[model samples]
Target chain A: MGEKVLMKGNEAVAEAAIRAGCRLYFAYPITPQSELIEYMSRMMPKVNGTFVQAESEIAAINMVYGAAGCGKRVMTSSSSPGISLKMEGISYIAGAELPAVIINVQRGGPGLGDIQPAQGDYFQATKGGGHGDYRLIVLAPSTVQEFADMAGSAFELADKYRNPVMILSDGLLGQMMEPVDFKPHKTEEELEELGKQHYDWCMHPNEDEPNHHHHEINSLEIDPLVLEKHVIHLGEKYDEIEKNEIRYEEYNISDDNDVLVVAFGTAARIVKSAIDELQEEGKSVGMIRPITVWPYPYKAIADRITSKIKKVVVFELNLGQMVEDVKLAVNGKIPVEFLGKVGGILFTPEEAKTKILENI
Target chain B: MEVIAQRPKSLRDIQFTYCPGCTHGISHRLIAESIDELGLRNKMMGVAPVGCSVFAYKFFNFDMAEAAHGRAPALATGMKRARPEMHVFTYQGDGDLAAIGTAEIIHAANRGEHISVFFVNNAIYGMTGGQMAPTTLPGMKTSTSPYGRDEKDIGYPITACEMLSSLKAPYFIERVSLLSPKEIIKAKKVVKKSLQFNKENRGFTFVEFVSTCPTNWGLDPIKARDWARENMFPYFPVKNFRDKSLNGGE
Candidate 1:
């Protein structure tokens, strides 16, 4: 176990990735996420690893694709617009069933939106941003500590499922400072053994073996029937993940509570602060923070949304994108309200508290 | 011993779904032969770009990755850096590399990633039913350029070798023709040497193979080769734009 240290959220993510056995990092510098790339560039050389400043966001994602193909632990980081540029590569990685870690320190969007913190990319992260029938396991972190801890879990899930894993945070998480306890690093030998066992599709030379046959890594199938079969297999895997990997946290949700606040990532942090304030003011309000956005804890919300809960408020940085999922989870048994900010501006705890009070 | 006529040892035995006379088969064979000769069959990982070659993952016997169009070079960069012990390369077409992937290729070369690039220039989009390509010569007719490629409107062809040679980081840049037996022989040598350089841990290497599209060009295979040699070659000339080995020898 490494000593606990105070670090910014972006810095913690970079440190956590290094500790998780990731050595190959390719990224292009984008605001909000620049510190993560810079940290890797400095640390990789010291660790005898490789860090490359890619030409563009497109190149960075593709480089990640290449590294992942070789059965190595790899990662990349970028801001909102840059992550949008990476969507095509992200789709390919998911389609090919390759394990890779991608971090999106989200900012305002729509087109070069803003460098400020925003959760506007919730839909793009959970939904298939690129063209295809595929899903990336989206992990949303609300605190710096969660940001550090989830990096290892993200890589583990990526390898376990042979899929892409995204750490969906925002500029506030990237910029804010907090305490973090570093995880133990996996040894090179351990990683090599893991790669050998799990990365059967990787390109390692077959030597002194006549029975060894060639393996291909591709996502193209011209025939509709063949493509459909492949898609069905992926769907089965996604279902399995949904059953096993759904994660969330409930704070002070009781039968007596009349309002439930649902949020994720940075918005959840603000919502938590708001909940604290409302509780101080003696209001019956509770919060639910989603940790995994894709394999959402829908059943948990549904089970809790009994007749006692009068309303559910969905707060995000986007224009009511995640509100749709919240409505589905609540099943319209109660009214759903939305409070959102767009183009990179983040909602404050004070603002959330005001919205909750207004609903009450 | 009876010789078996099949795919090369470096290539999987899976039958390619390419149309008859499609140059992708020839290009794949050349690449496989190069890997086999260089004894890099085990250490080689290929990045397959979108377009017709999206299934390049199925053909190569080595470990392969499928990348979105124009992103193969970027993927190759990451793969090579992650596993420097392995040789990384990307197989891309004109549309994937020259058009949509233009930014990827330029930066990969500029960064001097220790990888090789096998760029197949067939002028027209083969997978998408003959659309206009960035390397499509002016005045050439295609589904998208039905009125012919107007230089005043669509711009002239992009010479990848010449464009890449301008980058100081690249160690080698060559443009070869794959239309004739002699040209095929020459192209194979270029391909082999590039892989050898990769095995030696040389810097970025790029090879552009000017190929033919008989079906897309609405011509016979023989005429397609002839048309390419006469039309495409003059515009996108065939030659070694840069070679560290040649410079060292000199």
Candidate 2:
């Protein structure tokens, strides 16, 4: 922690990216995530990084694909409708095994829903939004500080796996301002070390070398057998990711609890408030707040289930997307219930409390 | 046994997958020769479009990326912006450039991004079985335009060089033909000049090669060239639209 300063979540992510030595930023203007791109536009020039306001979201993500192919730490941010346009490029990036970070500052949507907070992109982020057998290591941050921190963490995860990582945030998180402590900027030498990590496979000039080799950043494999093998190799990586990267926060979880609540992102924050009130009223409720929603903390939710726990309940901003994950985790051992609000509205703690009590 | 001409150092020894008599082979040779002639072979990176030239990554003996349909310019923009010191270019077909990727090509040129774009206009989509392309002639018949293209329905052919040159930023824009031996010789100079401009960091160099799709056009190699000269040349005339260097004072 260097110093605590007040910052919007979107601006904090931009600052964190710059501090983490991400110099290539390409994006289009969208409502909830515009501040992220706007911050990069103003700051990238000062740091001598490249920033382009691309023609559209599709172009922006493909630009990310190009930069990432060269082993440059690149990022693009978009809202929901804009993100739909980017799926084609994201699929290519995943198939090419390039390391890139995407920030989806989600607005409400099936299509251009509204410029308000919603967790509707949960399926789009964790499951494949793009056409492929791939997953984006999704980090759902509940607070501005976590949102800022996940920027650096997302880059690390992307590089570690040589896959794309998405920081799934929503309008409420993007617009909210809170105190945040950013890590120190990476030194010149550290940035150089990071750049070298992918040189063995990345596209770069090897002209002067005795053995000049070429690198192709491509995803098209016409041969079905070869593609099958490649997909299986990707599967192995996903398995490794699943084994090592499942992360969640357990709040007041114990055997004595009557009901277990599952939620993530901003919904989890509201649920925590509801749990606090429930405890005050002599009712015990615990929450499992998933941080990494892809290698979803399924076992964590399962292991915490004691005989005393009556039922499991899920709360979300969307019309019950994560509830499916909750049901899969519960595995029919316990009854699972869900309560959700859609169309850019967030359920209040009182509403959450009533839902939890109903499940109890 | 003196070797007067051998393969260009910038191209691999592997065989091309293009259909017999397709001008993609000619276009690849010209680009490879241009990179080799400029001595930028080692520092060059190319982007392959999602068309007949999608396997261009395998053909070009350098760093390359294959972009999605109509998105090669955007990909090249990213590559150039990432490695400003390294030379970058995109090899795109008419459908990839003029049709699906109109936004990307226009914006890349308008921004004067430091990259070269080689647009191959054969007037039809050869990879997807001769469908009508944005550069298809008004009355040209193809798989999609079975009854000949109607201007009211499909619209006129896009002259990419003219459209791109109208922008205030591109440093070079030229359209050349590979319809005949003499035209090919002329096309090579334009290709080399575009790469030279790229090497010199002259912004957004573009050259559209009026190429032939012999197999798709149901013509033999010789007749395809003759057909292109007769049918394609009038609509997509070979000309230099803009050259910043010729502007005298910038």
Q: Which 10 residues in a row give candidate 1 chain B its minimum summed lDDT?
A: B241-250
**What's the TM-score of each model vs. the native?**
0.94, 0.99
Model 1 TM-score is 0.94
Give model 1's DockQ, 2 decimals: 0.68
lDDT of 2 by residue, A184-228 (tens): 999999999988999988888775556787999999899999999
Clashes of 1: 9
i-RMSD of all predictions = 1.9, 0.8
- Taking the tens digit of each residue's C-alpha lDDT, what string does model 2 give over B1-250? 9999999989999999998888899989999998989999889999999888989999999999999999999999999989888999999999999989999999999999999999999999988999999988888889999999899986899999989878999999999988778888999999999888889897989999998998888889999888888888889888998888885824
lDDT of 1 by residue, B28-99 (tens): 999998898888887888888888878888888867777777888887877777777788898999999999
lDDT of 1 by residue, A1-360 (tens): 567788999999998898888888988899998999999999989877789888888888877877777777889899889999889888888888889999999988778877999988888999889988999999999999999999999999999998999999999999999989887887888777766865567756565457564556567777999999999999999999999999999987777677898999888887888888788778878788889998988888888787777889999989999889989998868899999988778778889989998887
Q: After superposition, how far is residue B63 of candidate 1 from its true place, in Å?
A: 2.1
Stretches of candidate 2 exceeding 4 Å from the true structure = B247-249
Q: Please, what is the whole-model Cα lDDT of each candidate in the order they appear?
A: 0.86, 0.92
Q: Clash pairs of candidate 2?
A: none
